[model samples]
Target: MCKAKNMIIENIDELTSRGNKKGRRIVLELVEETLNQVNYYNIVKEVTKLTNDILKIKDLELDLNGFKNVYVIGGGKNSSSMTRALEEVLDGRIAGGVVVEKEGYTTQTKHLLIVHGGHPIPSSDSVKAAEEVLRVLNKVGKDDLLLVCVSGGWTALTSKPPRGISLEDHIAMHRLLMNSGMTVEQMNIVRNHLSQLGRGKVPMFAKGATTIGLIAVDEVEGKPWGPTVPDSSKFSDAVRVLVDFDLLDKVPESIRKYLETAPPSEESPTPLDYMNNCLKVHNLVIADNIRLCESAQKIASKMGINAFVLSTSLRGEAKHVGAVVASIANEIANFNRPFRRPCLLIFGGETTVTIVGRSGEGGRNQELALSAAQYISEGSRIVIASIATDGTDGPTDIAGAIVDGTLVPRARRLGINVTQEQNEHNSSFVFKQTGDAVYARNTGTNLMDLILVYVE
Candidate 1:
């Protein structure tokens, strides 16, 4: 479904002066197409296809005779559409439940209850949705099933603060926490600690319910929601996050100055396994960065470029990783230790931006792309591109950047403001001036970002 492909570089004129529009538009279209290629629906379809063998569809496997029914429940940006697919597949078997997602989270049938919540920042409406989810879960029985559709935004969107710490404080802490560079798991530990409704607490509201977890792992690695299916996150780990962020004082005074009190983080009690009977929590990874790398590989092979997929779960600071990837490609070209010249190396992962500077477009992909571009300019014979699959990088609309050897000279000649751009943390601007920014409606699903370094 993603048809945006590469065009041969016939001449430099296409990206020079006024004629550069075509080059810019081509790059943008590529980004758009890739974004479209990664939508939740598309990702869900891919996930279902890959996991078809695992989904127990037939009631024949076990005794469904006395099982009252199955239902849907969850909250996130992608929860509704994904849950709808589940409802469509299960039909009458899915009796319906509460699903809280973005504002337009509507089910095709009137039987299901859809709740709208805020994103990035959870609003009062999200709190109401949380209450509604709890209310719905009260009706569950031993044989009932919980079909929870969870995506990246669940930690903030699906939860509400306890009796004391208000949502305002919760959000403030969350922003501080995310910008702090702690892993999502570490972040969630604190989050679950502050909230009354987290850990395995979601299904506890539903007595004897078996959970089917549909998840999108953005920051954490491997099994998403490990804390849910009876695995643990721990309360002390939450406090350590606060300490790590140097915000031990910022957490609400009632949050029990966890810094002054808890034992060593090594000896902390993680999220309790509250479920009486639990399912491994069937999680079919509907979407991830690996798909992007595979797609990039296909594109590269078609273009007669030797391709490689580095890693799907690559993590760390964007600039550091960018430099490392660029260095590797340089080594491959100069020494051919891994692969020879004219190779296309691709990587997929969620990279973090340590934004020490203020007033910047903080997308990690762009920052990394810029760093790679700088390396290419220094004689790597490389053309570089990196895009966030969600069509958004940090807070910018541009997916990422693309660059080549000529980028530096072009910027120097055209007064393209290189240092200023990087200083401002505007990867979008630097790539835009050189006709390299990718723009899409909504191509890639999840948080998969693509980094393509071309040597030829």
Candidate 2:
């Protein structure tokens, strides 16, 4: 490594690696800083703040008004944590509720029923438990208030099927949608519009129950995915998403047939009537991608690096996106444009990894890091990292990976090429051999990935 290259690596390592050395302390310090930024305290604080902004019907003494009982219902990776926050706010007012969350993450409360469910795909248990919830919803009357806590993973965790549609059909369609190239927002537009349980099924069934969503948003767009407030999407709009993505032809045969035959009618529910009460009553957005972005920036600044928040809502394909970030770093090195030396450019958002083949060990973030390696000049002074905030990126324990300009030769030495591997979605294998994978444990419930590039 040249003098400038060594300086850049030192600066990056100082921010990512932890130890007692000057660089180590700084790296540890930064990780801690970002970690602290996402502590239960801050998450609770933001959630509390949002909840407070809503109409405080509790102050009106719902019990006194004859709308006595308050029930909790939720689904997401953040569902359990969010339930805890809701319990703190509602105190003893909560009668009882059910919440489904990722395995090993549960929050028990006096009145909350926590259910463990699958993610990225719905399971039989999710449907069974969700059906049980529907039974509970059938019990709710006009006077009772139902507090629904919807977050990132709720789509798969909560469920009800449309007439004549098989559970297998729904599951297959969901899997295809996730693996498809459509964004969460675009996917949800079609999903919610199509499903009986979605498009405000919870709210409509529990009509006038004061539905509230404690959303931990994943999309870059300000509006949370799925039906939050009044879902503005029409059935045609939903179909158009499939058309635009060219994925309508790829969805499960049953789902495609259903979509083709389904009539456009007023009974085709969306989050309209319920949205009035839903948005007004909804409390927190447990957290957002921007929180993680700012946290990374603060950490980089502490490392004596000039930090820049590229964007909180960056989106697009993982490969193209990685290439763009790499281009920026190259420009910084050659032209010192946008940012000069000792710069840490940070971006946050969820990127997709399209696997057209059998597969290998890798997530979208890792693939992005590998693809970026080619754009970095050999011996150039730049290092980049892309990791999911949730700690686990994709199915692997590795959160993301870190790459320096030397990664190109490093991959070549391992009998791999960056461009070729990225095409195969074999980033995990490529980085594993070159030692660029960034694995972390306990990243918590936050979704989305963070990209950091240190350039000199």
Q: List the global CA lDDT of all models.
A: 0.62, 0.66
lDDT of 1 by residue, 1-456 (tens): 223253212222333233224333333333444445556655554454213223453221323444578777766655665666665556456676887765433434345777776665667876887788778778777787676776666656666776666677777776776676666667677776665456556655677666666666665275666224443656656767788778778766756453345444322223333422443244445555665567667765765667788787787877788888888877876888688877777777777766554745557888887876666644446666677665566656665666666676677777877667776677676776666565544332555577776666
The C-alpha TM-scores of every prediction are: 0.79, 0.83
**Model 1 regions more than 4 Å off:** 1-66, 102-113, 252-286, 302-304, 333-337, 378-381, 408-416, 432-435
Worst 10 residues of 2 by lDDT: 1-10
Off by over 4 Å in 2: 1-32, 39-41, 46-67, 104-111, 263-272, 275-286, 302-304
Candidate 1 global Cα RMSD: 5.4
C-alpha displacement of 179 in model 1, angstroms? 2.0
Predicted structure 1: lDDT: 0.62
Tell me, by lDDT, which candidate is best.
2
| Superposition TM-score, candidate 2 onto the true structure | 0.83
Per-residue lDDT of candidate 2, residues 64-110 (tens digit) = 24565777777766566666776777666667777777664455545
